[model samples]
Target: MPLNKTLSVLLLSLISGGALAAEAGTAFIALPGKAMLADAVRLAATVTAIDPATRTLTLQGDNGQARQVVAGPEVRNFAQIKVGDRVEVRLLESLSLELKKGGAGVRTRVDSVEAARAEDGSAPAGALARSTTVLADVIKVDAKTHSIELKGVSRKLKLKIDNPEQLKQIQVGDQIKGTYIDALGISVTPQPAK
Candidate 1:
C-alpha cells in the first residue's frame, strides 16, 4: 500500500499536464542512516478521451475518476491512442543503509541519469530514474524511543528505527550511508474487443 501511494504520486506528477516540461534527471545525497525501506507498484487505467492535436488523453480509473494527462514529444505514438486503449504505469523505489567500512572523512555522492527516447527524441514508453546516496555521521541514539539522529550531506535529522536490533548496529560518530532509487514508466495497449 505504501508503494502504491508512492507510485501514484510519482506517476501522476510526471504524467499530469503540470509536468509537461519535466525532463529526465538524477540526483544523489549522503547522510546518516536512521531507517531504510524499499518497494514497488504497478497500475493501469483505461483511456476515455484523446485529442491528438493537443497531445493529451483522459484516463478513467477503476474508481471512475477521470484524469487528464499530456504526452510530451517523447511519446512516439501519441497519435495511436484510442478511447478504449489501456495505459499502464510502473514505479520502483528502494533505500538501503550501510556503515562505512574502514573509511575516513567525507565521501562524495554518486548521481546518474538516463532516458529512453523515440527516433524523434521523444521519451515515449521510457523511464526516468534518479538514484541518490549519502554518507553521514551518527550524532545521537535513543534506545528507549527506537530512534537516532544523524548529520551528513546537508542538515541533521532524527528518525525512528523500525527494528530495535538495527539501532544496535550504529553508534555516535559512525558513518552511515544510504542509497535511494526511484523510477517511473508508462505504456499503452489496445483493449480487447468484447
Candidate 2:
C-alpha cells in the first residue's frame, strides 16, 4: 500500500491486529547547518471487537475513546489477535535537515523498507520501518517571521522556525537535505490463563 495510507491506518493496525515494541519519547536538537527532531508514542489498547470476515478490529483506549482499524496486507498474523488480548504498539518518527551551503541545487531521492516477523510462531511480533530522503533548494527565507521554504522536485514546504537564531543562519541560495523516517512495532500476548 501507499506510504500515506499505510501510516494513517498502521496505528490502529498496531493497536488491534498490529503490535509494537512499546517505546516512547520526544526530543529536538539544533545546530549549525544541522537539526534533528524525533517523537515516539507507546500505547496499550484492548481488542474490544474483531471481525474476521472484514478483517477489522475495534480498539478502546484508556480514556474510553474507540477506533476501528482494518488489517492491511502488511499484517500477516491477523489471526493471532483475539478479543481481550492486550496489544502494545510503538510508533517512532524522526526528521533531520542538513544545510549544504553551496550545493548545486540538484534534487535527489532515496527510499527503503525493512520488516521482520517472529520465527517461533508463539505470538504475533513484528517490526516495520521506512525512510525517505530528498535534497531541496532553499527557495525562500523570511527572517522577520522565522520561516524557511524548501522546494524539491515534486513538493514544496514552508515551515516555521521556533528559534530566531536558527532561521537567520540560512539563505535562499543554499540547499537543504532532509530525511524522514517512521517505524512501527507490535507485540500481541494472549490473556493470562485463569
- Candidate 1, number of clashes: 9
For each candidate, how many residue pairs have backbone atoms clashing (under 3 Å)? 9, 8
Clashing residue pairs found in predicted model 2: 13-18, 14-18, 19-185, 19-186, 19-187, 20-185, 20-186, 20-187
What lDDT does candidate 2 reach at residue 90? 73
lDDT of 1 by residue, 1-194 (tens): 33334334547754563323222323333344344465666666788888888877787765566778766554575666778887777667778778764353574578765555334433235566779887777778789999878786668778777676677777776777878788776667777878
lDDT of each: 0.65, 0.77
lDDT comparing candidate 2 with the true structure: 0.77
What local lDDT does model 2 show for residue 87?
70
* 41-115: candidate 2 lDDT, tens digit per residue: 888777889999988878776656667777765566778788988777778999999888867469888898877
Task: Return the number of clashes found in candidate 2.
Answer: 8
Angstrom error at residue 170, model 2: 1.2
